[model samples]
Target: MSTQARPGWMEKPRPVTQVGKAIALVVVVALVCVPFLTILSTSLASQGEVVENGGWVLWPTEPTLDAYRDILNGGIVTHALGVSIGVTAVGTTLSLLCTVFLAYALARPNVYGSKPVLLLVLFTFLFPPGMIPSFLVVKELGLLDSYASLVLPVLVNVFNLVVLRGFFQGIPEELYEAARLDGAGDLRILWTIVLPLSKAALAVVGLFYAVAYWNSWFYASLYMESDHWPLQQVLRTYVVAGEGLTDTTTGEGTVSAPQTVQMAVLVIATVPILIVYPFLQKYFTKGVLTGAIKS
Candidate 1:
C-alpha cells in the first residue's frame, strides 16, 4: 500500500476562502460601526437639526455639547444617571461576592450536600419561579420599594455559578494535593491559587453581572417610585415614550427639553457599556471556552 502526500494547495489556504472570509469580516465590522456612528452623530447634532431631519440624525450640520451639558447639569436625567451608577456599582460588587462564594463551595467535590445544593440551583434555571411569583416574593420580603429589590433576587446567577464551578473543577487535582502537602486549607488554596488563575472567567462573569444590573429597568420601575427611576427607565419615558423632560434644575426653568437632549440621554446611558465592552471582550472566548470544555 502506497501512502500519497496531499497536494500543497489542498493543504494550504485557498484564495477563494481567504477572500470570502475577508469580505465577511468587512461586512460585520461595517455593520457594527454604522450604528455606533449613527448614534454618536445623532447625539452630537443640534436640536433644530435633529427635529428637522425626523427623529434620526445621520450627520450633524453643526455639533453642540449643549445636549450633554443640559442632562449632566443636575436635571431628572442626571439624577437617573446617578441612580443607575449607584445600583450598578453596589449590585455588581454584591453579586460577584455571592457568586464567587457559592460557586467555590459547589466546586468542591467533598463539600457536604454540594450535589443537592447544585441540584437546587439548577432546578431554578429549569423552572424559574416566574416573574409574578418572584415579584410577590420581593413584595413579601418588603423589598418592593428598596434598592435591595435589584440585587437580592438576582444575587447569584445559576449559569455564572456553573461556569465558575466548571472552571474551578478544571484546576488540576494535583494542585490541591500539593497545596495540602504545604499545609494549605481550602480557603488558602482557593485565595492563593485558584482565584488568581481564574481571572479570565471571573472577569467574564463579573462583566455579565455588571451589564445585566446596569441595563435593568423593569425591576427598578416595578419596585421603585418615579423619582427613584434609573437612567434606562428615564430613557424609556423620554426617548421611547416621547415624553420630554422639563429642565427644572436650571434657574431658567420650565423650558421644553429638546428631543436632541433625550437622544443624548440614551447615548449617555449606553456609553458606559460601550467603554467597558472592549476590555471585557478579550476575556470572553478564553473564559467561556475554559468553563465549557471543563463542563
Candidate 2:
C-alpha cells in the first residue's frame, strides 16, 4: 500500500519573518564577544603599552606572559586562585546533594507536610532572614573564620529545588509503576532510573551552583579572614582597592607591572566559568523547559 503525501505547510521549518530577531542576535553576540576580547587583549599587552594608553588595552602591539609569571611566583593572586577552586568544588557537591533530596521529597504526592516545607522555602526568598540574624547563627555555630562559612549557609538553593522538583514530577507515572513491579524501592528507582534520566537537569543545576560558589565574594568577605579570602575578594582588594602585595610575595622592590597583573587576575577568575559554560549549555534548555512546564 502507498501512503498519501502530507501538506506543504507541515513540511517546512518556521520562517524567520522579522529583521528584529537577526539584529538582536548580532547585538547580543557582539556585546558578549567585546568584553572577552578586551580582557584577553589587556591580559596579553605589555606593561609599557598598558600604562601609556590608560588602564584599558584594546589590542596588544607586543604580547608577553610576564604578567602570568609574576602572579604565579607565589603572589597574592596565586594563593587566592587555589582558595577559589577548593571552595567551588566543595560547595557545588554539597549544594547538589541537598537540593536533590529536598526536591525529590517534595515532588512525591502527599509527602508529609511538603506544602508547608515548600512555602517555608519560598517565603525565605521574599523575606530573607536578616543578615544580622544569619551572621549570629553562623557565629553561634562557630563557623567564623572558617571555610564552612562559605558553603554551609548557602548549601541549598530554593530556586534550584523548585526546578528539580518540577522536573521530577514531570516523569511519567508508568515509569515508576514499571520500576515498582520490578521490585525497586523509591531509593532504588531514584538511583537506577530517575537520576539517569534526569542527568541533563542535574548537570544544568550543578553548573549553576558551581558558578555561584566560584564567583562568590560577599560571603567570603564577611566570614573569612582577609588572609584566607578567595580570588574575587583578593582581586577586589588588589585590583579594585589598589592595595598591592605582589612585590611583598615576589621579594622584589616593586611590582613588574600593576595593570598587567590586575588584568591577569581578572582573566584567571573568569576563565573557569568560561570553560564550564559551554559543556552545560546543551542541558540548560532541556532541563529548564521541563521544569518550567511542570512548575
Candidate 3:
C-alpha cells in the first residue's frame, strides 16, 4: 500500500480547478457588482453627463448629488422613505415576537394541541390562501387604507416559525429541566435561557422579517392609497411605471434627467439592505445551518 505525502485536507487543488473556481467567482462577483456600480454611477452623474451618455453611464465624469437632493427634499420619495422605515421597524418587531412565542410553544413537548396547531400552520404552506381571498379578508377586517394592512396579513411567516421551533428543540432538554427546578415558568425560561442562547437564530429570523417588510410593495399598493405608499411602491411608480417627476423641475423650468432620478431611487431603496446585511451576515450560516440541521 502507498500513501500520498500530502495530508488529505492540505492537498493542493489542481491548477486548472483552482483557475476555474477563480474565474467562476469573478464572474459571479461581476454579475452582482456591475449593475450596482452602474446604477450608483448613473445616479450620481450630472444631468448633462447622463444625457451625453445616451441613457446609462458606466462612470460619471463629474458626479453630483443633485438627483438625491431633489428627491429627498420634501418630495414623494421623502414621504415614502418615512413610510418604509416605519412599516419595517414595526412589522419586524411584531412578527418576531409572535413567531418566537408560537415557536417556543410548539417546541415544547406535550404542549396542548401543539401537533394540531403545527399542522394548521403547515397546511397554510401547502395551501396558501388565494390573493383575492386574502384581500377580501383584509377588506372585511377594515384594514384597507391603514398601516395594519401592510403588517397584519403576513405577520408570522411559517418558515421562520419552523426555523425557530427547530432551533428551540435543539436546545438541551436538561436546560429546561434545570430551569424548571429553579421554578422558572415557560416565559422566564424563554427570556432568560432560551432567547439568550438562541441569539444567532433570532438575529437571522429578525433580518428575514425586516427585509421582507422593507422590500414589500404590492400589499401597500393594493391596500393603501397612493399618498400612503411606501418607498418601494413609490419606486415602482417612478421606475416601473415610467412616471416623470415633472413637479420637481428647477427654477429654470428644466427637470433633471429621469434616468438619474430613477437610479437614485433604486440606490436609496437598496442601501438600507446593504447596510443591514453586514451585521446579520455572520449569524446566517451559524443560525440557519443549525436550525436546518436540527430540523
Going through the candidates in order, what is the number of backbone clashes in each?
A: 0, 0, 0
C-alpha lDDT score of every prediction, in listed order: 0.84, 0.84, 0.90
Residues 13-59 of candidate 2: C-alpha lDDT, one tens digit per residue: 33453356677888999999998888788888887898899877988
Alpha carbon deviation, residue 83, candidate 1 (Å): 1.3
Instruction: Encode model 1's per-residue lDDT on 120-188: one tens digit a residue.
Output: 988988888888988899999998778888888888888888889888888898998999999999999
lDDT per residue (tens digit) for residues 1-295 in model 3: 1145767777576788878888999999999999999999999998788888897899899899999998888877898999999999999999999999999999998689999998999899899999999999999999999999999999999989989999999899999999999999999999999999999999999999999999999999899998899999988877878765545434332343378888999999999999999999999998888767765
Q: Judging by lDDT against the true structure, name the best candidate.
A: 3
Where does candidate 3 stray beyond 4 Å? 1-12, 246-257
lDDT of 3: 0.90
Off by over 4 Å in 2: 1-25, 110-113, 246-257
